[model samples]
Target chain A: MTLNTWIDLVYLLAAIGFILALKGLSSPKHARNGNLLGAAAAAVAIGFTFAYPEVRAHTLNLVLTLVAMAIGAAIAVPAARMVKMTAMPQMVAIFNGVGGGAAALISIVVFLLEAPGKPAVYRIAEVLFGVLVGSVSFSGSAIAFAKLQELMTGRPITYPAQQAINAVVGVTIVALAVGTLVTGNVPLLVATAVLSLVLGVIFVLPIGGADVPVLISLLNSFTGLAVAASGFTLNNNLLIIAGTLVGASGILLTRMMSKAMGRSLANVLFSAFGSVVTAAGGADGSAESRPVKAGTPEDIGVLLAYARKVVIIPGYGLAVAQAQHTARELADLLMERGVEVFYAIHPVAGRMPGHMNVLLAEANVPYDELKEMDEANPEMSTADVALVIGANDTVNPAAKNTPGSPIYGMPIINADDAENIVFLKRSMRPGFAGIDNELLFDEKTTLLFGDAKDTLAKLVAAVKDA
Target chain B: MSTGILEFLTIFVLAALVGNEVIGRVPSILHTPLMSGSNAIHGIVLVGAILVMGSASGAMQVTLAFLAVLLATLNIVGGFVVTDRMLEMFKPKPVERAPKASDASGDDATGSPK
Candidate 1:
């Protein structure tokens, strides 16, 4: 057999590794090993790419490739290692964006190479597809990163004729893509590329911060499709398989994320869902005017220690205060006093799906102690106290009771079912949804205002004394 | 379409189905990790970048190919490293402490019952 055949076989093996890696990642027991296996597969594939006859013949190109790779690794390793767990969503966005950008560049370069000779019409179509989807994914992920990193406002940015403008741009891009396909005009493709980039930015801009996770997932799928288009242009089976895999899975994930929030993909994308602050729940006046029962940490702690069952609902605010460890300590203390305690995790609790799980796992919280929304909701009625740590919307009764509320019809944790509700919050500020939580003003709910970490620390001490 | 494209299309369709089937079962607890892991997998675009760069002749082609390689490299390295870091937290801890006995252990034992 020739060297080419042998290399193709190795590439096939690497592809299988990627499949197994995805399989392993889905299960908790094998997730870490699964990721390691994928890394190994990637390394093998890259190592073999260097052995290709064409690549080996170009010594200078090979040298340049190695140098560029070294520079990329230099930036990636430390950034990956040093990023705070809370910043993980944006980090993923940035990395995905760069990959999309790379795919777009590859397509553009191939198109440029073939333009001189009038490339095949089919090849031109593939190049245009890659340029459009890849550029969109690249810029869309950038905006997502900016939103998550708080470099810009997380709320949806909308103006008059916003949807109309986006529509016009979309049609223009399609027209340009057709122009490029018919005549193979370089300028037409460039215009398509530029407009696609603009389309990505505007596409993501109107999605509220809370919905960015779904947007990111959709953009991730777009990047995958773009890569697959590039694969078609290059006639590389490995790229086609890998890219299609991500594309399909990412779409499913995007749907799943939206479902978790009780919304459709289109609604999440176009509704600009949280842009308008609704005056529901009599929140028209300043928040300070509303009276809420504020309880001292010591008092709340005594109540928690004596309860037969306790449920802790954590949110983005808890993550912001870096209070996962303290929350775990409080749970441990409660369990010591014979209180049955478990964390109730909403699917979209943190910035990304399962984000809270990562934070709690870092704090050494046992997996069994973390109950999903479905499992925990049924137990809410039996619990004596619902300890809400830095969470708001997920536990808001407004979702069920307020029909006109933006978050209406969404499923929420039944925190109201518990006998007593103890909320640890910094202030009366609303959650990411920017709507008043009527539950906070309920009779059974008592607020403890402070930074989550400080309040949790105080609670731990108070629970111990009790 | 040529037989070559047809064959690729077949593979693409099958792979996408397989991906959807496999990923559908991933519980929500691992969604973030799954997203990032798949993000790393698609970084296979680096292979395409390398091939194009190898054949690049002019300065313009070389410059674009170099940027592609660089960006693709960043995607691969950063994607895998970040995913591994996130999954690392999910790794089952070694028995840090004895399991809590039904009686006097006071639930202070850090070891999970599992």
Candidate 2:
């Protein structure tokens, strides 16, 4: 067989490796190995591309490629390695953004190369699609990263005519894209690119922090589709397969994320839902003055020590205070006292879907001990104490009982079903949804005000004494 | 459309179907890891960047290709390494049978008081 044939076969093998890697990632037992396999597949593909006749002939380009890769690795390794677990969402955002940026650059360069000869109309269409979607994903992910990293406001930013403005921008981009297609004009393409970037930022600006995960998933899918468009431009099968896979999966994942919150994808995207906080806050101004029963750590610790069953519901505050370890310690102490202990995880808990699981896993909490919302809700009524640590919106009765509330119709943990409710919180501030949680003021609820980690430590000591 | 484009389109459609089927089964607990893993996979765009760079002419083309390679490299390298790190914590530790047994006994002792 010729060298070209052999190279194609190798690429095919690498493609199969990527498929298996994705399969392995979905399951708990094989996730790590699956990720490693994917890395190997990527390395093999990149290594073989070096042997392509054209690539090999260009010694200077090859040298530049190697140096660029080395520099990318230098920046990527340390950043990925040293990032705090709480910052994981934004880390993924930045990485995904860079990928989208890369896809746009590839499309633009290819368009420039083919422009001299006036490439086929279909090919130009592909290039334009890549430029549009890729640029949007790039800038959108950047905004997502900023919000999650606290570099900007995590709350949804809304203005009058927001939807109308976005629509105008969208229509202009389409017009510019058509202009590029008809004339094959580089400047028109550039204009399309810039407008698409602007659309991405405006598109993401009104999505609050709680909804950023779903937004990120959608952007991830956008990046995938952008890559697929580039694949069509380059006529690369491996890129086509990999990009299509990600695109399809990302869309499904985005749907799943929205479904988990009991909301539609469009509602999540366009509602500027959390912006109702200000209106809700103004209406419920007296909420802060409402009486809430306060308990000393010692008393609550004794209550926990003697309880037959205890359910822990952890939230973003738990992550923000770096309290997972302390929470685990508290669970262990309670378990030693013969209390049944398990963590009730909300689907949208801790800023992202499944985020609480990652944090708790990092703390060595057994997977079996971490229960999803549906599994934990039925058991809530039987629990003696529902210990809410640094969580608010997920367990809020407002999501269910108050139809007018910002977070209405969303599913929440039935924390009120427990015989007693003990909350560990820093203050009376509302959660990410920016709505009041009436559950906090329920008759059976007891508030223990303090930092999560410090309060968890205090609860552990109090339990030990009991 | 040419037969070549048609074939590529067929492949793309089939791949999308396969992706939806496989990814549909992943439980919510692994959603974060799944997203990150797929993020790494799309880094396959690096191949396109490399191929274009190989035949690039003039300073502008080279400059754009270089940036593409750099960004794609970051996507692949950072994406995979970070995913591995996230999944590393997911590796199940040997369930401490000893603790469970002791926990059972401790339950008995504490159960009488309640």
Best by lDDT: 2
What is the per-residue lDDT of model 1 for residues A353-380, given as tens digits with 9 covering 90 to 100?
9999998887778888999999999999
lDDT of 1 at B2: 92
Per-candidate DockQ values are 0.59, 0.48
lDDT of 1 by residue, B29-79 (tens): 788998999898999999999999998878988999999999999899999
- Listing every candidate in turn, what is its Cα RMSD in Å to the true structure after a full C-alpha superposition? 3.1, 3.9
lDDT tens readout by residue for model 2, A1-466: 9887877788889888888988899898999999999999989988888878987678888888788889988999999999987888899999999999999999999999999898889999999999999999999999999999889867678777777788899899989998999999999999999998998999998887778999998999989999999999998888888898899989999999888999999978877744554534524567889999999999999999999999999999999898887887788778876899999999988888888998888776778899999999999999999999999989999878876665666789999999999999999988877667888899999999999988987888898888
Off by over 4 Å in 2: A273-286, B97-114
Evaluated on chain B only, what is the TM-score of candidate 1? 0.80
Single-chain TM-score of chain A, each candidate: 0.95, 0.95
**How far off is residue A71 in model 1, in Å?**
0.9
Error of 2 at A445 (Å): 2.1
